[model samples]
Target: MEIYNDHKKLFTAALCLFLLLTFFVAIGPAFTSQNNNAPLPGSKPLSSLQTEGKAVFIAEGCVACHTQQVRNVEMDKVWGPRPNVAADYANITRTDVWRNTATLMGSERTGPDLTNIGTRQPGDDWHYLHLFNPRSVVSQSVMPSYEWLFDIKDYAWPNDVVVNVPDDFKKGISGKIVASHKAMALVAYLKSLKEVTLPDGKPVPLFLYGKTAAEKAGGATSKGAGTKSGPDGEALYATNCQSCHQGNGEGLVGAFPALKGSKVVLDDNAELQVTIIMKGYNGRVSEGYGEMPPVGTNNNLKPEEVAAIVNHERSSWGNNSKKVTVDDVKKIIASFDKPASVAAKK
Candidate 1:
């Protein structure tokens, strides 16, 4: 009766209840999650450059179109090796003392999910060129060019890393495009977004309604997209090498060399082919094409992964060549003293 009748008493009780409710509903769960969850194994905290890049990623409004998360679904399998667990984002924190974007798990997915982009596209050359002009690589890309992140230099300095944008898409700009510090930072951040491998023998949650799940349930299902031997070469090619070498294997003129009917690709001996992939190729720079970064090395790819990519190119697009095994590629790699490139002789 006193609580109801007395204004002071009613206010006090309501305030206490509200505080208790908030602590129990919001604060309690958050603290519990923080204690229980940890960042995934092998997920490193951002490097200095990567941190700077993340700031650019946020400031440039990349959060509006792209998403950091890969949902637990069949389609999302393309975005990551496995569905995201709470541990995947355990390290994310508030932006600052006053602001937080809550891990930037954005709502709209206007662009491809970036969860595994690091593993898919690890090289910086393509990224730099693509950032300067989205249409340069992806003809139908609706993403706006991040030209502010580059400098148009009439004569690039010896130490400068210049981007080789295609002639057609250059829009009559005479100067060479050089990546600015912000662009370098942003690419570093983008290149850091790889999913960590789960511990051994731990059952991965099957992508829902997907072939893995269906097969596990003893239901009739189409074969999974993976190749019978190892990794799916076609999928690897699509993710890793497709940007420069167009889908049909006709590379962009004056940018990337065409793979279609290339003698190196068709050659039965895969020595030069494997070398070019393992070590970055710059021999063609004299002929207007851009230098290719050592994709296999940059991504820390396994021998099987490189072999798969090699096999894909050799067998695809009317270029029929005998596929080389992982062991064969490994032997070639062992001959080299680490992963520095050699001048590829065509």
Candidate 2:
């Protein structure tokens, strides 16, 4: 009884309780979340370029100003479709044995949550310009320039990646500002930060409060009643195309090509457009438009979804073209072997 009442014994007991509460009660569930065990449905491992860029991002302390996390608060709706869940970041792997900077879910919104940047503002030119001079694209931006990642080459080589800067932002620097390999890698990493949609029936953080049950119940309506009205095309475009190509199909100048009144878009035959979307476009092919990294192959876009995007692009922006069906897109996709012949057709 004396030992139990002693100050030393009581102090030891309190210390043990504190440790248990800290480790087990407060922190244990976070480490044991089920979502951490598996990658989200559309999650993919970062490529070599993206990995290097991630290192630059961390090395530069980008996380100090920007956050990768989207909270469940109504104010955070601008960041992503839904508040972030553990599954959203499940696929991020450690950079190496010594570094584990893969999970860069920052807590500050000094910039913005980059969770869906790939689907929001995904153009090499725009990213480069933003890095070179933040105010060029966003007048209110306070972010510093990462000009060291770029090179002001006297003349660009045939295969060099050039950063297209507007005349106003250009400070009379005599040559083209070509992006170094590091800049490309950093852009790749930023572009790879898109959010993968949670699988059906999975519960997401409730940004729309008091509507969880209603949302689950309304899932049936998302199926659509018929073919033309189906959510596939518009939904797919919103997910894959809307970022670089603006919501109105008028893409950013010097960055992404405009779909409105574009010769390729207005062409009766959809083969070339389909091919470009599937295989990607090299910037060297055109003088103005920047390189469009292949969207279909890496993203695993299905034939039907590609067709949907094609139809959406063609039909929108005052374009009066016949709606190309999935069957039509499938034929073009199948003819990948005969590129010379496929591209030859007008």
Candidate 3:
């Protein structure tokens, strides 16, 4: 009996020591006088709206579904961003809120990652519409509606009279009481997401510029590539073409053909390039890599903008050619009604 009691006493003492050590260690860090050296990228201090939205997010158990920390391999390649570092967490408060380290690690991805949600789909109108009714916009979305959070306002036309809500949104509330400040705040938080820019304040892999290494290396001949297009053309090219073709015009090998010495860009005949851009391409002619979809599919780019991009590609790359005017594009578009075989034979 004495031996058992002695063992029990020793076990109690060891347990007490362990508890004391854990308490001290946890409290020491909590009370430390260290300054935060890391700052959030592209983030100002949390605004009142952001703070409120964050509270709402927690209250609604959003963290249970969404994750903010991107994994390394997921970051470097597919996601076009890096994993969250300790510095990235510096701005996030660790008090009543879950600490970046302890909140939940390796949690299942039940919902889409919210780490880069802000920049993923940016548009105030889009967010407003989506929040009003998820099923209205996305036929297959499973997200619950937070309609109570928003006030709906009647649409006003140039005459300043109220317009009826569209048939699809007829069930939705109308009037000034239909929008939610909380929803807007949450959307704002999501729109603020962006990958950390490089030390030089530029995106990584540098090929985004579409310029060849020789052009980047101060080669005098390559200097005027994208410059001749002027600001409008340059902007159009940057947004539409830079992703695949890169800024240097070297393109992504067989995936995207090089504009630097492209026969299509240099040829006096503009039909091939214009047709490909307008209607898109498929078949073995483009090396069987699959079809190029119509540029206007996004619905954001205008016909004039498409012409500008074509002009920029033709003029900017190493294959300097005569500029393609909007009038030329319009004429080509008009002629497109005829069959392709006939057009090619001509």
Candidate 3 residue 79 Cα shift, in angstroms, is: 4.4
Question: TM-score, each model?
Answer: 0.77, 0.59, 0.45
Top model by lDDT, which number? Answer: 1
lDDT (tens digit, per residue) of candidate 3 on 14-86: 8999989887887666555235435545545556676666766766667786777666652323233456555
Candidate 2 lDDT over 1-346, as tens digits, reads 7758799998898899999999887688768764457787779999988889998998889988888888888778767778887666777777789867658777677787788887665557779888987766665678888999999989899888887776677788778899898888999999998878778997766785444766545543211112633335666776676656767787666666788888878888888888888877774446766677667765667886787778777777797676677788888888877765575553
- Candidate with top TM-score is 1
Two-way TM-score contest, 2 vs 3, winner: 2
Q: Which rank order by TM-score, best down to worst?
A: 1, 2, 3
| lDDT (CA) per prediction | 0.81, 0.76, 0.56
C-alpha positional error of residue 63 in candidate 2 after TM-score superposition, expressed in Å: 3.2
Candidate 1 lDDT over 1-346, as tens digits, reads: 8779999999999999999999999999989989999887788988889888999998999999999899988889878878988888887766568976357788899989998888777767778878888887888899999999999898999877788777888888899888899999999999999888877887887678677644545532211122454566777778778888987899988778999999889989888888888787887889977787777776666887788888889878898887888888888888776445333234
**Residue 39 lDDT, candidate 1, scale 0-100:** 80
lDDT of 3: 0.56
As for lDDT, the candidate ahead, 1 or 3, is 1
